[model samples]
Target: MKNYILITLTNALGLYIASLLFPAITLSSIAAVLWAGLLLATISLFLKPLLLLISLPINFITFGLFTLLINAWLIQLSAYLAKGVSIPNFKYALIPAIIIFALNRARLSLIHDKS
Candidate 1:
């Protein structure tokens, strides 16, 4: 439970940073960032696995590159569900997804090394 909350907060921070860095991504307010972050975390936790399972063959063939697309799709879906989060286009969502994915990889590696 604590881990879930931490992950959600990290995602929120990532989104906040993305919004600051990308003109195409916008959060109407701080509350909006929180809502968007929660929505994104929920979608990632729930929908992403199903999509990943459904696309497993392609994921294998693409050498896991399809996972990036899945991340982007989740981002787009979260933006659609969260009223105050706006992604102007699918292309814009890709960048933030990639950024977040890279950050997560770095974080996991740091934890792994520490352990």
Candidate 2:
């Protein structure tokens, strides 16, 4: 649980940074964005792994490529849930989704390595 919260906070930090960099990604305010990111990260904790498992055949056939689309969906969902956040297009969501993936990978790796 602690690890999950830490990861969520990190993801929120990444989203906050993204908002600062893209006008189209702006939230009504920083507080709203923080809430959105937390909610997104919480949702992702269960969703990403389950979706990956359920989509295993497609993921295998696509050589892991379809994961990007799943990520895009997750990002779009986050935007939808967020009261004040918005994304301009698929491209905008893709960029941040990829960033979040990278962060997740790095975090998991570091955690495993520290054991």
Candidate 3:
């Protein structure tokens, strides 16, 4: 539960930062940010592992760089499901996906460091 909340908050912060960095990514309101964040976190938790497993061959062939594409696709998926959050296209989503991935890694490292 705690981890879920942390991931959601991190995702929200990432989305907010992405919106600031990319004009093409528009989050209409704080509520939209929160909703998108929650949706993203949920999707990442439920779908990401399955995607990684299914894409293992391609991911391995790409030296794991294919994970970025997966992240971007997940971001696009979240945008599709969330209201008032618009990511123009897959190209526009890549950077934000990178940002969110960095944020999630940083958050995990911080948590690990505390333990």
Please write out the lDDT profile of model 1 over residues 1-115, one tens digit for every residue: 8667766776777787888898789889988777877888888898989999999999999999999999888888888888889998889888778878877777778878998
Candidate 3 lDDT score relative to the true structure: 0.93
Q: What stretches of model 1 exceed 4 Å from their correct place? A: none
Better candidate number, 2 or 3, judged by lDDT:
3
TM-score for candidate 2: 0.82
What C-alpha lDDT values do all the predictions have? 0.84, 0.80, 0.93
**What TM-score does each of the candidates earn?**
0.90, 0.82, 0.96
Error of 3 at 20 (Å): 0.2
Q: Quote the positional error of residue 43 for candidate 2 in Å.
A: 2.0
Question: Quick one: best TM-score, which candidate?
Answer: 3
Error of 2 at 41 (Å): 2.0
Q: Which pairs clash in model 2? A: none
Candidate 1 accuracy as lDDT: 0.84
Lowest-sum lDDT 10-residue window in model 2: 8-17
